[model samples]
Target: MFSDRFDQLVQALRILPSVGPKSAQRMALHMIMKNREGAIGLAQALTEATDHIHECTICHSLTEDDVCHICSSHERDDELLCVVESPADVMAIEQSGSFRGKYHVLGGHLSPLDGIGPEEIGIPYLIQRLSQGKVKEVILATNATVEGQATAHYLVEASKHLPLHITRIAQGVPQGGELEYVDSHTLSQAVHNRMRMK
Candidate 1:
């Protein structure tokens, strides 16, 4: 319903997560009308960031440097590892300021139907990290969704024999809510009130 250029913009916008055709059109028009320069800057930033960013070798979080800030920081506890589904979760935890441990980004949760299994999401890497005998505790900070729960259970079962204490981040994170969307206060409380899984 738009010109070729406008349609191209809409198509590009639709590739983003949670953006539908209507939203893509609305955003495209909004950018075109409100501030074209700002829109161009946004596009440039996206391009530059995506091109420059690479996964942190130690944690798998997006970073321009070889190691992420958390992995390199002396302030973070090396003996505690927080296992999260994505980098966004790391940011949320960091923002809450409740955890001072390093993180291991799983890349994503296990979804057999989607062909995302243990190997695909770096579960083996996690086991290897545990085998090194540095980390003492692993906080299963995956989301509360079915896939997240399944991933957490799998990790717990797999690492049962290892010399590490496994704990899951508390629930009560509003049903269908994500870590990135939860407020800092609620996230802090959840981290503080985390319970050991039986």
Candidate 2:
């Protein structure tokens, strides 16, 4: 239905999450017709970000440096840790400006069907961090998805021996909500209304 280059562009766009073939085609054609400059800028930005971003050594959040700004900031509370499923979750929390603690990015959630396990997403590292003695509380900020809940439970079990308070963000978030998609006010409210796991 389109030229080889256009078809290739659509296929590439389709690789993005939730972007079906129709949407991808629409985007490709839009780029070709309406917003060529913006499209070029977007492509360049994507390439640059992909090339420069590296995982933070301490928290696994994306950063250009070895450590992310949040990890390096002395203003944040080192005794509080927010465990999230990805860097995007960290960003969502940051946008809310409600949390002034450190973060630990899990990289991904626990999904048995997808074969992602504790070892696959650096849960061991988080346990090790908790063992270091300064952390007082851990906020489970993973998404409200099933896999996210499973990951949170795994973390709770793993940190059982540690002298730390573990809590999960509240559920003002709609079902099937991703942290990245949640608005700042809702995310902030969730953090403020966090509850301890029974």
Candidate 3:
């Protein structure tokens, strides 16, 4: 219920996840009235980030370079690879300071209803990477949701013949919990106490 420009701004704001129409409208108004400078800065940052950030060629994580920092780091353990649903999960695990290994982001979990299967989430690519023989262990760090569990199990089955040790992050994270919302301590514990999935 506003001018075309205002409505357009609200709609743009609504593109953010979980932002409803009303919340978007409120945000638009707040930015226009109370924080125009911040809004401009945010706009510039968003444009720059969107223009420059691309997926890391190796791990599929958001990065401005061909390889992400974690993937290029020499100090990190190359033999240990952590599989996660998204780059956000990688950030969560990094913040925990419990894992010093490389990562493979699946982008999403398998959801048959959504028609997202192994091929859609790059499972074959992961298997190809595993086949290189540099990695010795893989940690399944997907969320605790049913879809996450199913995806992890599928990965286990898909890589059964590979000469690699597969493990799932242990309990501590509540059922249905996503890594992004979990505390550092809990995530650290989960990483430290992971269980074999074989």
lDDT of each: 0.92, 0.91, 0.95
| Native-to-model Cα distance after best TM-score fit, residue 160 in candidate 2, in Å | 1.8
Candidate number that wins on lDDT, 1 or 3: 3
In candidate 2, what are the lDDT values of residues 85-149, reduced to their tens digit?
98889999999999999999999998878888889998888898899998999999999877888
lDDT of 2 at 138: 98
After superposition, the stretches of candidate 2 with alpha carbons farther than 4 Å from their true spots are 172-198
Itemize residue pairs with steric clashes in candidate 3: none
Instruction: Report, for all candidates in order, the number of backbone clashes.
Output: 0, 0, 0
If candidate 3 were superposed on the true structure by all CA atoms, what would the RMSD be?
A: 6.2
List the candidate numbers ranked by lDDT, top first. 3, 1, 2
Q: Model 1: residues >4 Å from true position, as ranges?
A: 172-198
Worst 10 residues of 2 by lDDT: 168-177
TM-score computed on alpha carbons, candidate 1: 0.81
Clashing pairs in 2: none
What ranges in model 3 sit over 4 Å off?
A: 172-198
lDDT of 1 by residue, 74-181 (tens): 988999999999999989998998998899999999999999999999999999999999999999999978899999999999898898999988665677879999
Question: After aligning candidate 1 to the native by TM-score, how far in Å is the CA of 83 from where it should be?
Answer: 0.4
